[model samples]
Target: MKRCLDEAVLQAYLDGELSGDAALETQAHLAACSQCAAALNAAEGEGAFLAAAFAPDDSVNVPTVQLRARIDAAVARLDAQPETNARPSGGWNFGALLASFTSLLTFTPQRAAGFAGMLSCVVLAALFFSIQKPSPAPNSPAQEEHMAFVTQPPAQPKDGSANVEVKDAPTAPTPEINRSGVPIQVAKFNRPHASKPRVKAAPVASSLAAPVASKAQPLPGEKDYEQAIASLSTAISHGGDAVLKPQVRAQYERNLAVLDKAIEETRLVARRNPKDKDAVDFLMSAYQSKIELLTTVADQAQVAALGR
Candidate 1:
């Protein structure tokens, strides 16, 4: 007997892909060969099972026309309705405000005159109140008495310095004519001598340079500096890239060491003489530089992380 047909030849024969003579030959071979016939039957059974499993159901019907009509009606109603360009209330819409202003501008001149007159009346009322002064209140008896005393002339001295009669000094005699025909008075009185006022001398620069108090006080924002230092230290410890390049780490360490030494020296000087403002300022500046360096390192670390 001939060898069993290839599974491909049998599948092609079942699918009607074989030529007429080849298909007839395959059918004869399958009828004479029980093994080939059983294989073909199994393939046919699998194909039918798959087809049945995936076939479309006849019971689940779709009403395409009705659904299409409903959708069309909804679309037609939407198209018929007018679209409104609504906006949120209380918003500053410049275009709308401008339109309103233009509408107002279209009014007749009489309305404009009325508006102007109303504005003028408001301005006039404001000016009247601003320019007017309150009426003065009547003075009390004591105030009147005080005013009278202040208006009274001062008493003349015994030396007759004023043009009033003095009790101890006699009045001037009638004027006599001099050789040049000018009238001259012949009375004389003793005048009191005025004393000079004593003046205080200005303070010397060396005396003004003396320290007023000795108790040491910290510089302004000292606590803020400490806080920044602590925060940056914590961030350096907990944050930044997991690993930094060796060279970068070395350079940052060197800078930190130099700043640390400088800060230490400044602290010593400030401790020796807490009143030394320059030393305190130097210490504060060193701290600020250290903070800046740490900040730079943190930034570089972030860059490195992002590159990664």
Candidate 2:
């Protein structure tokens, strides 16, 4: 029989990873061996010490009432802020904020005062501009021309001769001056045309017809559907080509061709009769079907890569 058990064998025995026979033998050895028993005691004591030292701190745990109060305060602050400023729920980091605040306090009062004065000056200038009545801007070249039309001087007598009888010009398409001093070209709608228009815009049939039942209850999680399709399409377009076997690639191409044909036909129907709700629904369904197929192909490629 061996005089002593190896340290590694004793460790395996403690961990219960040894065979049943080895475990029994180790048990018998520990019974007779004083040094081995002492080593085991020491190992257990070290483990207990480590577990107690590194365990979670109960003091750091926030109370439910305090946490709720903090969350309510955050929500109130977010509501008070402008829409452009973000109000994320899980974005707080108290440690980082404390560090930033400490750094800010390190600045001298004089430096801070200089910045504050500059800000005050800016606010005063803004208030002055807002309250003061702005002087009228000089007339532009276009405005000057428009003013001439409105303020035409009366015909003067040439030395002794009476002023020539000035008749009004023909009422043709000419630019007229508006109150804003901008020249507006008065468009003549009554143009003597030889023939009517060759092609006219199609009238909305749905607008003319009576209202049908509102079948357009919003699609739940429509944003999720769009996001998933976009992510799958991007993944497939980039690295998926490298993972695809030749046979799988050929199959995907054939399926895609079929989907493309269906999409084209449905889109044509939708374009022809935009007022037809059924046609629009068919078109959208076809697009979604195509996106689903693309996602499946990309997922298959991803699984193959993982297996490899």
Candidate 3:
């Protein structure tokens, strides 16, 4: 600007809010002054960025008809609510409020009806209080009798009904207590041949247990486990005896011995109890262990070859 452009005016111009002679003058100044032009360009860039950044994500949503009308109506209703916060410009105006209230009290049918309704409410409340009976005082005989009735057991009826037990009110039943302090059921005393409290039998353990876990059953392929172990062992030994490190070779031999022993023991178990799931599982595991040992040695041999 010939005169440095005010930031606010420059902002307004960038927003396309400035018009007429002012806009024309701003355009001319921007063209002549590189500094103002740079500022205007920066402002434009910032405005564009802000607009894009805060823009509503409308791509995924279906456009609603009359969106502006709905928004405007909501804003109008918000503005129309009566404000309770009176302006503090004149401070408190008690006298003015009192005068207004007095004016409202002038004789009118509406006021008369309101007064009648209020008087009716007062009368009803007074009548309710007046009709309520007072409870007996603590020391009174009636109060004592009420307390005794609750705390003391009912007196047995005289006459022929003396043999019959009676209760003034049917109180909640209390369970019968045995000598051990356990609550036993209170069976009907009137029932014939009622002697002992029936005891519930303990639950028995079921024979079923998930048919043994899937892994606990024999592995698939009748001879596959045997073939796999043999093949893996042949692969490991084919690399030659001295190829393995001393410690590694010892460990491998030891593992093989253990696997062999496990296999023999499992075979014996399986032969004795072919139908036993545990024995079958043990036999399968022994074969798998041998296979794993062979695979480990084969991998080590390959690693050694790569190192060479």
Tens-digit lDDT track of model 2 for 22-76: 8888888888998888877777787788778867764466599988999999999
Which is better, 2 or 3, measured by lDDT?
3
Work out the TM-score per prediction.
0.28, 0.25, 0.27
Q: Write the per-residue lDDT of candidate 1 for residues 1-308, one digit (tens) a residue.
A: 89999889978977899998998888899899999999999989988997888677745688999999999999999999876655657788788889999988886899889889999999999999988968889663345445744675544334443343224444556778999999887776656555443333333333323322221344567668778888877777765635678887888889899998877656645644667787778888998999899887777666666677
Model 3: lDDT of residue 61: 64
Q: What is the lDDT, from 0 to 100, of the residue 291 in candidate 3? A: 82
lDDT tens digits, residue span 1-308, model 3: 14778789998887689878999988888889888888888988998898788678634565466787898899999899888655557587787789888988786998899999999999999999988968765453234334644674434323323343333443455699889999987745433443443333322112122222322454445378878877776766665456787997898899889888867656644543467787678778788778877888887776666677
Clashes of each: 0, 0, 0
lDDT for every model?
Answer: 0.74, 0.68, 0.69
Report the lDDT of model 2 for residue 300. Answer: 75
> Model 2: clashing residue pairs?
none
- Where is the poorest 10-residue window by lDDT in model 2? 209-218
lDDT of 2 at 160: 40
Q: Name the TM-score of candidate 3.
A: 0.27
